[model samples]
Target: MIPEQRRDFIYRYVHEKNVASFNELAELMNVSHMTVRRDILALEEEGKVVLINGGIKLNNLLKLELPWREKAELNHDVKRKMGELAAMLIEPGQTIYLDAGTSIFEVAKAVAASNCFNLTVVTNDFSISHYLMDMPHITLYHTGGLVEKRNRSCLGKSAANFLSTINIDVAFISSSSWDLERGMSTPDEGKASVKEMVLQVSKRRVLVSDSSKFGKYAMFHICALSQLTDIICDTALPDDACQTLAAQNLKLHLVSTEREQNHA
Candidate 1:
């Protein structure tokens, strides 16, 4: 296997086992101990694992967020469907805010594919800005601030301040964690600030996230569920959760991944 695949294997293995010895991982991957050691060191640097007593353990505390590329690989099809559904909400000549995260990145891709014209797109994600930059019909703006390289986005006071000056027609916010109790939250305070500002300035505050992020909670609180005007996510979200959202009179768009797969 290639280095990335090998590292992915090691990460999944260690995550499943919780803690594993060098010998155990090396034997499992059928690679030399040296190779396993190198991979472990790399994972350690990424804060996904920790070395201890000739073994490696998943870093429960520090592994709250995955790098952008890694997160993009997860639930890829589901995110795409969510994106396409979100794109349908856009109208030509409207100013929209796309939040930073893989889920929102998929929305950016869908928006590009939909051939929407004369739209002003604002974002903090470098990836999204680059993707939509050359489109003749779209005007793209990036929020400049302290760069969070891992997620390929900008955050902090500078980014939040930039957002405060703009009025957004629709804001498609992304979050790593959310629930009924804490609402939407993030581990990074800077991200929270930016998202909060987007919600405050936007006319339609829509949240674009996946089913997997539904029950989770992060360290920093952004806003409550009632703050959102709409939520677009995969249909795999739980029934009870759907009922709760309905009770709040929030518009919920649940994209069907299975239907998309069948159409594909």
Candidate 2:
């Protein structure tokens, strides 16, 4: 395999396992021990991993971002609640923008199922467009630009420029991580640009995320909680964080898993 592909494999393997032994990596890659050691040293210089006794551990500071596929499998139940609640907030004949993320994807699904006719849905996510495209009542506009295969979305200046020209009633945005201090953040600058542009152009901005996303910040800053019109998250958010959001006067919508189960 090429160097980038090899490093990506090693990164994913170590990230999934949290820590990996030198022997394990060498065997997995069918490479010599020295070759594996060299690769590990290289990753260390990039601040992606740390060498320990006989193994390497992922850099905790740099572990803030997970690929979209891995992230989609997490917090499914919480995302469902957030999605359902966000869908209820929308009215018929409204133009909406669904930002690229798993939680926002759920919102797209919810909007589609609501049978809301003459709805204009704009998205950069291939999954969301695919989900709503066939519905006759919904008009879908996908922003095309540089494609990030892992996130399965388009980003960069072209996508952001397209969003700027349109009038969005509400935009459902999400990120790889968020913190009270850094606000919303993502690993990719291109993705951050698209999200920032969406927030700037939308009439009402709704941040749809899970509680676990709190207290984590990534490489690029999207926007602070205070900038959002509404924040929708699961109830697992800490009391302190809730207080912070309240202090900022941001509209906070917390969904309870228990309530959803009971209602079901």
Please, what's the RMSD in Å of model 1?
5.2
- lDDT of residue 16 for candidate 1: 38
Q: Please provide, for model 2 over 86-117, each residue's C-alpha lDDT reduced to its tens digit, 9 standing for 90 to 100.
A: 99888889999999888998898898889677
Once model 1 is optimally superposed onto the true structure by TM-score, how far is the C-alpha of residue 19 displaced, in angstroms? 15
Model 1 global lDDT (CA atoms, 0 to 1): 0.87
TM-score of each: 0.79, 0.78
Show where candidate 1 strays beyond 4 Å.
1-63, 258-264
lDDT of each: 0.87, 0.84
Q: What is candidate 1's lDDT per residue for 96-196, written digit by digit as tens?
A: 99999999999999999987899999999999999998888899999999999999999999999999999999999998778888899888888889998
Which residue segments of model 2 deviate by more than 4 Å?
1-64, 258-264
- The deviation in Å at residue 130 for candidate 2 is 0.8
Cα RMSD (Å) per model?
5.2, 5.0
Error of 2 at 125 (Å): 0.4
